[model samples]
Target: MIIHGNRFTLRPDADAAQIEEALESLRNQGRVIPSVKSFVVGRDFGGEYEWGATFMIEDLQGYWEYLVHPAHRNTDQVGLPLVDKFASFDITDDPDPEMGAKIAALHQRRYDSDATLTQLVSDLGEYKGSAAPGAHGER
Candidate 1:
């Protein structure tokens, strides 16, 4: 499965009601893609960022499906006009499915490691949306 961390900035001035409307809309939209195995949107209570949601996608294609879905396009309708963008980190495991827990633990460690400072610096050097740092010919 691929895990994508989506960050959105609701219209800077949007009130709590507007934010709820956007989140509720996503919840009510039902399944937009078959591969969207599971996803839940919620306010980012964490003080670090504005808002974010973790999506569990069955595959890259499934992630694309939801990206182009009409429901996603309507983000502005519910008052979330500013999409800070998304940070998608692929998670892969070995052959043994029974090792899921161990794999998750490893992945969590990777996520928590502060070594990402190097990546953060590199990304800042030439960041563009969420693609590669120096991917030319890309929008």
Candidate 2:
């Protein structure tokens, strides 16, 4: 299985209503996305981030589906602007040595294909790891 996790800190100007809506959207994503085998989203106690989420997928295809799913994009639209800092990490048990690069490529392609997504990410205070724009000096 592939496990993808995202950690973020909301902007100071983010209101309570938007935060609740974004949290609900995060919860809805796991329920609506067929490719998500399991997921969780909640407060982060020990981490630097204020909130975090993890999504479990069966394989690369499922990961791709999770990435491109409308719910995921919707979550981005609602959540990205509220975010001050964002980062993602992926863990997989697959045997392929190139799996990490493949995952990053998928993210890169997603950002490349979606101008809105690229802009949302670019507007953030900071974004790190995986397919993050300029994470590898690309985009």
lDDT of model 1 at residue 107?
Answer: 34
Candidate 1 displacement at residue 100 in angstroms: 22
Note the Cα lDDT for every prediction shown.
0.48, 0.90
Alpha carbon RMSD to native, model 2: 1.6
Mind giving the per-residue lDDT tens digits that candidate 1 earns over 1-139? 7655545444456577766777766664445655567776776775544566666766545655655566754643453343333332335433555443433343333324434422432433122233222222122
**Best by the lDDT measure:** 2
Clash pairs of candidate 2?
none
> Which ten-residue region of model 1 has the weakest summed lDDT?
130-139
Clashes of 1: 0
Error of 2 at 50 (Å): 0.3
Q: Estimate each model's TM-score.
A: 0.53, 0.95
Residue range with the least summed lDDT across 10 consecutive positions in model 2:
130-139
